[model samples]
Target: MEFLFQILVILLAARLLSEVSERVGMPGILGEILAGLLLGLLIVEETETIASVAELGAIFLLFTAGYKEVHIEDLKASSKKAIVATFFQIAAAFIAGFALGRFFGFDFVESLFLAVAFSPTSIGVVVKTLLDMGYLSSKPGSMMLTSAIFDDIIGIFLLSIVVTVGKYNAFPTATQFMLLLGKLVFFVGIMVILGYRVFPYIFNYVQKMHSKESIFAAVVLIALFSAYFAEIMELDAVIGAFIGGVMLSNVAVAKINDIQSKVSGLAYGILVPIFFAHIGMAVELEALNTLGSFTILVVVLALLGKLIGGFVGARAIGFDSYESFIFGSGVMPRAGVELVVISIGREMGIIGEEIFSAVVLMVVVSIIISPIILKFAIQKDKQKNTSVPAS
Candidate 1:
């Protein structure tokens, strides 16, 4: 009964607030997050069940993101720009965090963890924002999605290095680092093989089944399986889910469209809301009381780092100024991956509570602010394009 009540309240609040947000020219997620934060003040404790459901929300969000909005060819086409963008974005964010840490008298290991925390762009946030603004199929959107994927991969590698240093007080050896790299390569290689060569036949057979909804069930199963496989390889599960979605995108079955619609409905209408709200509920609002100049600097630098990195990378690849700004805004929001890194660091005693709180604040600010900036940039670009005569 208690669990049921919590779900009921969360859903109603999220939907109500989301409607309000959308009517006001902002993304609905902003309201859903606010709903969670309000409930957080009253609920006091989050149940494990809620957390698990939220995790599924994220998985399904990424899975549908890949299945519906992004095609394999889009990913391939954007690969070069995505790589360049990700390289600059990660490098800038990492440097900013490290420099801040050193300036504040932290040692090498602490500084390294700070750098790792600053480097990742949240796939869920970026994808949700792009979907909200109807830009997921655009060139900037494709690049953002691909760049976020690479960011997660690099984040995993950096986290591994940070953990090693924190636990053993030394950096990972050359062989150890190589083994880690091998795991990443193997995961991507297997995913490509399975997605291109194997899953097509499997899904084709499933769709032809007489069983009710067999294709849908198979897709869900494959998504879950892929996510689990990625986890065992020390990679993020969202990556696996995304790859699974991308792989199934080329299935030529008649019901593919229906399946994608169902998947999208389930993800966005139910699960994804819970995911965003859960992130909001996790915020310790009291952290605001502890904010200082250093915390303010951390937030500023974190946002600026990604913005500059994305803009520079996009411009280098010949994107116009407006397109570059859109890309920069798209990469600014940090959530799940950043939170995980800081939480692990806190637990391992590699960073103090002060640093952890500052990063959390940064995440909150980014998720709240980035959507508004990105939405405005997108709208402005649309207006500009429409004003010009077609070439």
Candidate 2:
């Protein structure tokens, strides 16, 4: 009964706040997060069941992102820019984070974990904002999505390395690094074969079934199975869920759209909101109060690192100044993966509450700021284009 009431209150609060946020020209997610913060102030307990549901929310959120936003073929065809930009973005952010940690007197391992936390762009937040602004299919959006895919894969791999080293208090040997790379390659190769050569045929038959939800069921099963497979292999489950969605994206466009709508309804309406709220609830407000300087430093570095890296990479790939700035703005927000990285670091005792709280604050601030900047960039671009003389 208590659990039921908790869900009810969270849902009601999230919906109301989200509606209010949208009306005020802010992202609905910001409101959902605020709802969580409000509830946290009012209620002290966070149950295990709530945590489990939140995890599901994250999974479904990524799964739907892959299904709706990513286009593998498009990513492959124009991946050069994304790859280069992702490299620079990760490099810049990682180095900046490490420097900040060292300045604060953290040990090498802790500094490295902080670096890893800042390296990946959070696709969930970026995708939501782009979709909201009707830019998900624009050139800048494609670049952001493709770059984010690489960011996630590389980030997770780096995280595995960091966690292993932190656990043993020793750097990984060459052989250990090779083994990790081998595992990653093997997973991708198998997913490619199964997704292309096997799953389509199976899904084709499933689509013909008379049951109303067969396609949806099959897609969910595949997503869950892929997530389980990745977790068992010591990689992030969201990675698998995302790849699974990408794999099935081209199989049955019409039926997939239907399934996507239903999944989106389930995710956004309930699961995803809970995920955002959980992030809010988990924040240690007291830690933030004590870590004010550190929080400010992190927020600045996290924003500028990704922004500069993205801008430079986009320019190198031939985007004009305005477009490059938009790309930079698009990748500035960090949330889902950043949270996961820091949470794991904290659990391993490699990061204290202060650093964790500071990063959470950074994520929230980035989330709020990135979309507003991106929207501004988009409108500016539109005005510039409109004023240009016809060729």
Candidate 3:
């Protein structure tokens, strides 16, 4: 009963602030985040139940991102560009973070973990922004989405290295690295094969069931199963949910649209809001009182790392100046994987409280600011496109 009441309060606050945020011409996500911040300040400390629900929110959020916004064909088309962009983006962020840590007197292992924490773009945040702004299928959007996925995959590898260093006080052996790589390849191959060859048939049969919302139930089940599977394989649940969504996307059943509609309702109307709000709630605002300069440096370097790296990669791939800017801005947000990495570090007693707080503050700042810049870039590009006369 107490937990239920807490959820009621959270939902009410999140939804109300979201509407207020939209009215003020900011993204509703910002409002939801603010709501959480306020609630955290006034009453709510992070609880296990709320955190679990928030994780579910992230899973459904990514699932919807994959299902409704990003397409497999688009991912394939942008694969090469995304890989290049991701490499540069992660490299820049990692280097900057490591340098910052070292300058702040952290040891080598701590510096490495700090670098790894700030290195990945938050896919859920990017997807939400793109979906909200109707840019998910655009050229930049496709590139951004693919690049973010690559960032997550790289983050997983980096996390393994950092964990090994933290736990065993040594680098992972080549065999361990190769095993992780093999697992990644196997997971992707199996999921892709199943998505293309099996899911459609399953959904077609599911649609014929007399049970009400059976297709919806089946989708939810698959999403949960995929998320659990990913966890067991040492990958993020969002990745599994996303792959499941992509697989279910191609189902050509009669009520496919309806199924998507239901999923969207559940994801956006409920889970996703909680996810964003939870991010805000998790922010250690008081940490900034002592580490103001450190927090600011983290935020600035984190943004610049992705922006400069993304720009160089996109330009190398032949994107023009403005387009390169869009690509850079699109990849600037950090959440999801970064938070998980820092949390793990803290749990393992490697990351001190002060450092953890600084990173958390940085994540919140990046999440709040990056989307606004991306939106501006997107809108500016639209204006430029419209002003030009057709040949």
Candidate 4:
């Protein structure tokens, strides 16, 4: 009962803060994170539960992103460019992060883990920015989405690798590393192949039932259950849920969209806000204060890494100067999804208190700038044309 009450307070506070931020022309996520921090300071002990619940929000956020953003044709058309740009971003970010961490006196595993965090672009932030800028239908929007999808895949893999390395001091032997890699690959491959084949059949059969409630129940069951199974496979549940959503891409967009809309209402209206509030609860004032300077430096470097990486990577893949900036800016935000990775690192014991505090603060800063960064870059190219959506 106490927990439930805390959740209610958190949700109401977050909603109110979000509204106030919007009224002031600031991004809502910034307000949300700051609210979490203030609450965390006021009620420090609740931060743990907040972290855990927000973790679920992270999963649902990913699933929501995957469900909403992917379009097969755009992906297919831009496959080559997407692949090139994504790899470049991954490599550049990883190396830069690795170097920075080592220079900052982190050990091999710590450096590697931080590097892995740096390497992946935050997909949810990117998509939101794209939608806000009205660029979801434009060429740059398509590229951003494609690169982000690949970024999620690549980032997850890098994180898993870093976790494995952290577990073994000198790095696992080649054979052992490969074996773990194989297990991960097999797990993801089987889920994707089998899931794509099964979900459509299940949805079709459920459709025949002709009951809205039944259909919704079935969808919920599928999404959550798939997420559970993914967790069991030593992968992120959100990844599973996200994949579950994408597999349904072949479904009737209108119907699946309708289902997602409903699912999202429950998710966003109740579950998701609860999750975000939990993120607020988890912020550590003392640790963040201690690491304030370092945290700011990290936020700046991470932002630059994403920006430069997105730009150089996009240009390398044949995008023009303006488009490259779009690619860079599209990936500037770091919020829900990145926090999920940090939570996972915490769970695995790879992220200590200092790192966690820095990440939470970094998230706050990055999210604050995400919209502005995306808008500036976009308008740089289209000042005379229709404005891009900068959601």
- Model 3's TM-score against the true structure: 0.78
Question: Clashing residue pairs in candidate 2, if any?
Answer: none
Total backbone collisions, model 3: 0
- What local distance difference test score does each model get? 0.78, 0.79, 0.77, 0.71
- Candidate 2 residue-pair clash tally: 0
For candidate 4, lDDT tens digit of each residue in 254-318? 24656777878877766677666666666667776787776776777777888888899888877
TM-score winner: 4
Residue 281 lDDT in candidate 4? 64
- How would the candidate models be sorted by TM-score, starting from the highest? 4, 2, 3, 1
Better of 1 and 2 by TM-score: 2
Q: What root-mean-square deviation over C-alphas does model 3 reach?
A: 4.8
Off by over 4 Å in 2: 107-109, 122-170, 208-212, 253-255, 315-327, 343-350, 371-391
State, as a TM-score between 0 and 1, how close model 4 is to the true structure: 0.83
lDDT of 3 by residue, 1-391 (tens): 8788878878889999999977865557767878888898888778899988888887887677567765556556666767887898889889999999999998887888889987888755566677887888987788887786566557666875677667644455788767666766787788888777777778779878999988889889889988888768766576678777766667666237777888889987888788777766766777777778887898889899888988888888888777788888888887656766776676567887667777767776777788788888878887778888653
Which residue pairs show backbone clashes in model 1?
Answer: none
Q: Could you tell me the lDDT of residue 326 within candidate 1?
A: 91
Q: Which of 2 and 4 is the better model by TM-score?
A: 4
TM-score for each of the candidates: 0.75, 0.83, 0.78, 0.83
Deviating ranges (above 4 Å) for candidate 4: 47-52, 122-142, 166-170, 208-212, 253-257, 318-323, 374-391
